[model samples]
Target chain A: MSTLAFLGEFGEAIQFIFEGETTREGTQVGGSQFLELTVEHIKVSVVAMVVACALAIPLGLWLGHIRRGSFLAISLSNVGRAVPSLALIAFFVAYLGVGFTNVTLALVLLAIPPILTNAYVGVTQVHRETVDAARGMGMTEARIALRVELPLALPLIFGGIKTSAVNVIATATIAPLAGVTTLGDAIINVSGYGDVGRLAAAISVAALAVMTELTLGAAQRAVTPRGIRLESGRPSRRRTLSTRIGRTASP
Target chain B: MVASAVAALTAPLAQVQLRDRSGGDAGCVADDGLCPGWIADNFDRYVDPLVQHVYLVLASVAIGFAISFALALVAHRHRWMIAPIVQVTGILYTLPSIAVFFLLLPLTGRGSLTAIVALVAYSLLIIFRNITTGLDNVPEEARDAGRGMGLTDRQLLWRVELPLALPEIMAGLRIATTTTVGLATLAFFAGAGGLGGQIFADINFKSNVVVAGGLAVLLAAVLDAAILLAQRAITPWTRARAA
Candidate 1:
């Protein structure tokens, strides 16, 4: 339970990597360690998150900027929300077999909706007058969207990204079933070994998560455009009330 | 045609039920007859576990909502404090389920208590942020008018701001409910029970019917419906708006 003991397990793995004693499958001087499991999991999560960000960002921008197909994008994102990511991951495993590729695909699918929805909402929510002013100043539509609208929406978009990153990082623990190694490997493998290792790895992942949260949050705030507030400091009761009414009318 | 189609569809189902075990290979005992009974027994095994699963999610979400709502109210009054708290909660919200569960295991052990604590921590950020945002969105003029009319702080919150914020708060609850249901699946990994157990069983046994897959889908539907109903009941305003 001491920090030293906690670091002992994690640090040993690091030392193994540094000492070149660790094999791809995780056998070491002691033979047949769980390092490979750890590597596979880390790889699965990283690859999946990278892929998701790649696809989702562009789609989100389009949906956020274009405003026409925004509903389609938002709805797809909503459906993503509705269907549990774990179920989707399981389904992929069922259909595609347990492996890195399928697991990554599932995580990518899971990560997209938040990113896409947030980006789209962020851009769309950029004030109409701001867009008009930009246009009046003779900025091109693309230029306006990129320079003006994007900056305005950056905070919200980053907020979305922050949210997605947390989700992906946490859900990555489940990637083990798809034959991808992850932090969950320890939790699952060491369940019989007194759960100490499991607890240790869990703490490590949580630490990693807290670190990830702080880092991304700083990054989000950094990228988030400042000095833009809605003319109304708070969304008026009448406005929200009206929007609620409108939403109800359609549904 | 219908009979033949049904048989054809069931052929795959039968095959899945008969597959070899992947992880829990030791337990994949095959029975050529009584497939229905096999499925029934599989479900029966889960009765106790499934109850635990439902209990874990409901309890954690309820606790999380209460804590988050209280915090949100405090933040609402002290507007300057909202950002930091929201940011901090947002970070907590992002912690991986396994990570959070594992992190808490030292103190909580591998029990429902650990899972609930972790889940409640995760839920707090979302629920708190949403409630604060909802309450904040209540008109300042309305609040000022309430105060001008000699309404106390509590009176303003309950009679004015809370009602106005109900819709958004309910939306937050819906989001929290769905997220809790999904995350609760991880509880099985920790031995807390529920649809995850069924799904895990199916996964290990390679039986599609009993594999955590089918049962999870069913449980998800039920959870979704239950939350939707709860949302409707708590925010009768939502119904009023709809009507």
Candidate 2:
């Protein structure tokens, strides 16, 4: 098919989401279906992210402050890569029975690694002397973490959030399989939505995923301190030789 | 459950029949518990999907590597191409594979080809970043010495830069390969017939899911290990240095 034909179909699909479409069985699949499912998708994704942040950020920041668990923090994402999301969901369904809570919990586990890893890296990347100076000024450990380290690590932590958000959103596309009617029903439930509805729903979820990524990206930029933003262009001598030697386009 | 167990235990070993995944023991299947005997009997069902899964991973990673290698080299030489290329591939990488699988279905049709295309798009950013980082990390002195010896840019890249970049390049390949393995489980959505199809076929079946899903994880581990081993063998210098 031509690109024009595809676009026309895509446009029609989008309109169908707003106006609703009826299946051959004469069921009224209304426009609200799209909004309803997308909202659920966001709801679950948001809940998962909030829980992941609550669990991972503090643990990661504490580990980094104490200078422990380096191996675990760094290797988590790598190990995460080997495990398939589908399997994780299926495993949950098989063992625990399927529901919103089960799927959400699985997603929470899936989303944790990137956030935890990034939080650890972000905090540990802070200068030791900076933390020392905070200590020397009579700040408590908790105060130093909140006042000195958290601000510096804000951009990277937000980066992890963006990543986890995108991942959780993507994984949520399959949440329908476990009995939650998210936007994925458009893709998975052909009988209910038909071909055009599937395409339309896919487009909507893709847009949502991209929008989340961009919004978080902007948040990351906003959180970055001006001094760090300016200094990011300059090579750091403090890093190990392996990291410092790279002569590439600036970050 | 007890009756089903008695039936399973009383059945003569030689008389075992190939029951459907859900056909094995009534209580066992009802409970969705792992029926090992049924799995061994039905193991053949997974072979084809597992092979399809392997093909999806290999073809996508190979194609992704070729494209990324060319782009990385171009970006290395021009310097200006890096940002745009990274941005574009990063978007491709960020888009969920399930979405990409369907998004391409209209344009590319529903088949392994569509699945491979989506999978390849994902590997581009990962492999490209690593390849470029590897290229860039080659010591300045090595390049200067090659230049002083009257070596041209092409010769220097092939003989020194690429070889030196092997470690990072291999790391990228390992990551891309493993990630593709995980993602290919979803290629069943594109009608690519992978282990994912098998798992999804009877998702609630404990035995079916365990075997099928376990195989996918095993495939990722095997490919990752193969790449790590290949990297070590090719870059004998790295091993020697460590020793």
Question: Which candidate leads the pack in TM-score?
Answer: 2
Note the residue pairs that clash in candidate 1. A40-A181, A41-A181, A41-A182, A170-B96, B198-B212, B199-B212, B202-B211
Query: What digit string (tens of lDDT, one per residue) describes model 2 on residues A19-51?
Result: 887777877664976888888999999998999
lDDT (10s digit) by residue, model 1, range B15-34:
11234322222333442221
- Number of the top-ranking candidate, with lDDT as the measure: 2
DockQ of 1: 0.21
Can you write out model 1's per-residue Cα lDDT over A122-208, one digit (the tens) per residue?
Answer: 777777998999999999988987889778767666766666777777777777766776766665554222243455456556766
How much lDDT does each candidate structure score?
A: 0.64, 0.83
Which runs of model 2 end up more than 4 angstroms from their true locations? A235-251, B1-19, B22-24
Kept native contacts, as fractions per model, are: 0.32, 0.59
lDDT per residue for candidate 2 within B1-243, as digits (tens), equals 334324422331212123355446778877778987778777898898899899999999999999999998888889878779988998998899999988886677667999999999999988888888788778999999999999999999999999999988888888889889988988888778789888777788899889999999999999998988898889999989999
- For candidate 2 chain B, the 10 contiguous residues with the lowest summed lDDT are B8-17
Model 2 lDDT, residue A82, Cα: 86
State how far residue A72 of model 2 sits from its true place (Å): 1.3
